[model samples]
Target: MPHSVHTRSDTVQPRPAAAASRGRWTYRLGRWLGIDVYVHATFLALLAFFGLRAGLSGGAGAGLEQVAWMVALFGSVVLHEYGHALAARSFGIGTQDITLYPIGGVARLNAMPRSPGAELIVAAAGPLVNMALAFVFALGHTLSADAGQGAFNAAGELAWPLQFAVMNLGLGIFNLVPAFPMDGGRILRALLATLGNRVRATVWAARVGRVLALGFVVAGLFGNPMLMLLGAFVWFGAGAEAGAAVREEQLLGASVQQAMSRRFLTLSPWTQLGELAQRELDMTLLEDGVFPVESGGAVVGIVTAEALRDGLHDLGPKGYVADVMTRDILCVRPSDELSGTLRALHGRTLAAAPVVMAGRLVGMLTPRGVAAFMGGPQLRHA
Candidate 1:
């Protein structure tokens, strides 16, 4: 298929202010090599600092060359991310977009590959891209014996060819380390997944990642701060991945009925506002008003706090809940899977939704309820 024809889906809304802040330091565009890409704002600062350092330490000539090399280095990072995106695309998974952060590039795939083998390929493709670049540079260096070894030396003064080769090689090698948020860690998870269940594999891989991350932290505190930051990234990434794995396990065979909140408070149409405030609304610990119950076969919609406050002014304390209640209800059936329900929540602007079954409201599924279900100690198993 033509790369430009690749399909895109709305995974999440972009925060304009956040994107603006990020754009100041990096490039932002759609369709680079037929893939959407974004470069964060910090990449500029990184380039500027290194460029100035090279200039001050060497000369204008050296600085300009080094800056060019730095750009190429990040360019390689972009290619690495694309490797993953493209691999995922081949499997019919969609890539939201690739964002180049200060640390590295991130290709936000809509969902992880369901198969372990596919995941291994997607994860390995990135580091493989770096390896290819490194091989090309190495071959060039070897074929041209006239080129001095000084150009390849990391300890020596900044040189474009040497820095480029070293960065590419290092990136390829570093990403192979089995740590969370790194390609190696993903490779580990995929391999383990083939031998066991995904959740178990995730748990094992995450544990290994945490241990490796700690090793990096200790090493960084003694000498390299960069290693420390990378360690922290790995640590948190592993924890988050583990938690997601846990949630996935719970959602595997369960539906909305299993998790939705029962015994929810509801306000009857024509009920006095004062009575609602005293009975249904006040009893529930939530600050939000009760779900307005529909009458005369009408759908019930949510009424905001402002609507109730306004009703008080016009209808007095004796006025009914129906006077200010909204009537456009959007709800989901109890049989729907939790993941599908979560997706619906994102697609809709509703803060809370009623769960219905057999033409009757069975429960409420609010943001708090979902969070509680995900965070609860009891693990729902298949």
Candidate 2:
């Protein structure tokens, strides 16, 4: 249940190393428990707010202590994610990385294991980590109090150690809530998955998550702002999960030919860049660029704006397309399964791939094309 509402395996797919560069700061924290972890840049902003609030209300000492506690809390969160990563790894699933955002943490893995038992273990492991941490803190509190240690209190009544221990225990319990994007929701899905289709279970759980998100939002109206933000996150995250499930379902039995753009334009490798650019500028067609249909009249390569830009920097716009065209191309047959094609898309660094049938270019498949299909094109027609 601890790993339930945070279920976001769909948004993950292999992407360019350059995209990872955007999360460079996220990687700076280095690795923990042999798993790479990146905390987002916005987390620093949160720290600033934490410091500012502590300064205003409790002075430097109190502010610094709160910051320290927050850091420790996040440390616990990272370990909680590692619980998921470790359990998944034990099942032969590979984790991408665990990225910590202001809201919570995300452990990106390659794919869900087929076994419901394995999925259940991976999902349950996260909450166990939280509970473990709470117990450790509670034990420490007992030891410290017994040693006649001074209570960390602002007033006569508040016991800081006990309060901290109790808060962690409450957090551990709250995370077990049976709602999608939370641990309980995942438990529901895993249990249901054993009875029916995994997709169907996900759909039902996601609906529950959405309902929970709405409830949180309504409750936040008279309560904490943090709960309101968490509510919004849950609302959007649930919708995204459902949308992804629907998209995958739509692509299940199709082929590249069904989704590819048939309006593909071809270019000669020997064609000058200036000429190609002029031609593209003058054309009424939505010509992004052209693929090189090889010297033997077979699809061989693709030349994009990036290729053209590299050419322009080296030999001006007069540079031939062949000079900049990428010969290391990946293509797929029109009859290839859409699921396989999507997997290929994730594997390749290219933004688009040329669709070939019997060595002839037929259509083009790009990320944008995929989006267009999902957004406007009728999947039923395909």
Candidate 3:
């Protein structure tokens, strides 16, 4: 059975934004309906592994047939993810990309719908697609059977159409297991969110998911290694979802002013990359790598230590900071909620953003700074 994972765009970790943006270990398949699709390298290995196993048991023809079936199944998986992306699009949310992995597919949405109803619709879309596919495949199987075709092929295996139909049906039902990070879990969370705070809902959903995951693991001990893998995915995914929900809740209770760095270095647009690099070396203790560029008494852009190093090496140390600085910068207000502002920064995949008020740069905010604040005594006690 195939499953879909939804990733929120705002969940940025303490890593280089450039590194975070790169699609590592995945090959671009192409784009459809303004959404890019990628297949992980491991997916191919999975196909090869299955093909080899089938070949050893049967023959080359069986191996080829199995590979074709797997491809078709994953094609259905892709459509499953598209179901999620298109549904989110209807809610005015954009998808970053859809990547197919050995386990299943993931649709990275710019943001999850805030409304419970909207979230319920988005979460249910994928399984609905699978169920719809199952119906179509079942109809095809019925038609083929009525036309004097056997359910099993000459190879004594189930007909491809029947297999597809059963697989889609299983996919639809398995994903509705109400496990956190799964469609059913999201549906449960959405329904629970209607009654109270979303964080509490998420916590409840995660607890249920963990229990189900443990059941899966125990059942897998009898047979089915795939079930074991799925159990692990559910276990870890639920924990992550619960943790993120709590972190988001904590951020919502704080303001940018409480977490932002009040003391930070600023640079002139005319500053040479060489000079900036030397200053960066001197300020080795500085935790923040981003520096706002001020020109004519206004913040113009921002540059990172990575950019400074690259500029020095590429432009021979004489390149102006303006040449390398990013002009399209995300700026947050001092009064803005840290949660929302952090989401904006992560949506843009920015490493850091400047805190501006009254057209003046008051401070800087980075994921690291936010982590420090989140770990501080004030939030710790709360």
Q: What lDDT does candidate 2 reach at residue 255?
A: 79
Tens-digit lDDT string for candidate 1 (1-382): 0011112121112123434433454566668656678876676787889899999999999899788877787788888888888888889887767777767777777677869999899888888888888888766766764746545456666455555677888888888888854788889999999996999989999999999989999999999788888888889778777777767776677787777778776656777877655654452344543363756644466565556767877888898777787665567888888766666665554556678777677887665566567665422210
Cα miss at 147, model 1 (Å)?
A: 11
Give model 2's TM-score versus the native structure: 0.80
User: On a 0 to 100 scale, what is the lDDT of residue 96 in model 2?
Assistant: 65
Off by over 4 Å in 2: 1-14, 18-27, 48-61, 136-164, 280-292, 305-317, 372-382
lDDT of 3 at 324: 90
List ranges where model 1 is wrong by over 4 Å: 1-30, 140-163, 268-280, 287-293, 303-330, 349-351, 376-382
Candidate 2 lDDT (Cα, whole model)? 0.70
Candidate 3: 10-residue stretch with minimal lDDT: 373-382
- What would the per-residue lDDT of candidate 3 be over residues 1-382, giving only the tens digit for each residue? 5354555523444323321453577888999999889888899999999999999899999899889989988898888889989999999998878888888888878678878899999999998998999899878788757566678877898877778888888877888899988999999999999997999999999999999999989889998888888899889888877876777677776999998888778889998878766765655524347788999988889888778778889997789999999998888898998877777776577778899999889999865678777663222110
State in Å the error of residue 331, model 1: 3.1
Candidate 1: 10-residue stretch with minimal lDDT: 1-10
Model 2 residue-pair collision total: 11
